[model samples]
Target: MTIESSRAEISRFRSAAVAGTLTFDPDAARRCADLYEEQAEHLAQLRQALENASETEGFGGFVSAQQLQAGFAHKARDAAELLDRYIEAAYRMKEAFLLSAGLYDEADAAAAAALRAVDTRVRG
Candidate 1:
């Protein structure tokens, strides 16, 4: 595929990643994960295709098969890096949700302590 097509695919994957994280619904989150997985696979395929093309036609001035393979390897590495960032973002969002829920626990603890303090004051 052309560079334009590759960029478009990357954009689509990035959008899906963002959408999945922004959504609060469990179903949507699952969809997002699925999309991310699909995107990663596509990226891998694209990288291989580019490597093959470069080998056959001396891709953009690549002098040898080794150079073509290296280019694809770099592309694959970039895709993996992007995937890691997306996963990390998802994890952080989940952590934030848990922390929000924990606030109620903190509130209950504080209330219980206040009650104990009042009881001791009255008894003393």
Candidate 2:
């Protein structure tokens, strides 16, 4: 893909984030976790595809096999690195959802404790 295409995808994701379309609430944390796993697998596959592939068309005087392999490695590295950042963002969002859930639980417990105290005092 060209640089413009890459930028467009990045812009799309950023816009989604701005729209809260990527929201990961506590109830959907499980789904987000699954997505993170899938993304990890996808990235691994991309890396493996490049790492395991043999040189191509280096037979042409235009480029050597080593240069072609290096080019492939460079592209793979860039793709993998970009994907890793996105996956990490997803992971962070999942963690945020989990943390928010925990905070809610703590707040609920606190409210219950306060209610119990009020009840006890009022009944005495």
Candidate 3:
């Protein structure tokens, strides 16, 4: 995706968050975190599998095949790097979800406490 597109999506998400149009559900956030963790693990496994399958041992007799395999290996390494970045992003997303859940829950508790204090003063 383009940088502009990513910025736009981030802006939209921020706007929604600021407007409270998106409700924060701790349970949902936790579920999203779990999903992200799973995705990261899957990507890691996929990257390892790709590396294993890209080995040049089977094509030793053919110089052309070895060259092709070398090219494939290079591309595979690039792909593995990209996958590693994606896995890192997934973990970051998971952390963000968990942190937001904790922050929002704390805010809610604080608000409830303030309201209860107001209630007691009003009764007095």
Assess each prediction's global lDDT (C-alpha) against the native: 0.44, 0.49, 0.61
After superposition, candidate 3 runs with Cα above 4 Å error? 2-23, 103-124
* Residues 1-124 of candidate 3: C-alpha lDDT, one tens digit per residue: 9434643654564355546565457888778767877887798798788778666477676889889889998888777766665665555555555545564553344334334433433542
Candidates 1 and 2 compared: the better one by lDDT is 2
Model 1 lDDT tens row, 1-124: 7434644654554444344542334445445444544554454455456444544443565467668767776765555444333333333333333223333343244334334433533442
Q: List the residue pairs that clash in candidate 1.
A: none
Candidate 1 vs 3: which has more TM-score: 3
lDDT for model 2, please.
Answer: 0.49
Q: Residue pairs in steric clash, candidate 3?
A: none
lDDT-wise, the better of 1 and 3 is 3
Question: What's the CA RMSD for each of the models?
Answer: 19.4, 17.7, 15.6
User: Highest TM-score, which number?
Assistant: 3
Put the candidates in lDDT order, highest first.
3, 2, 1
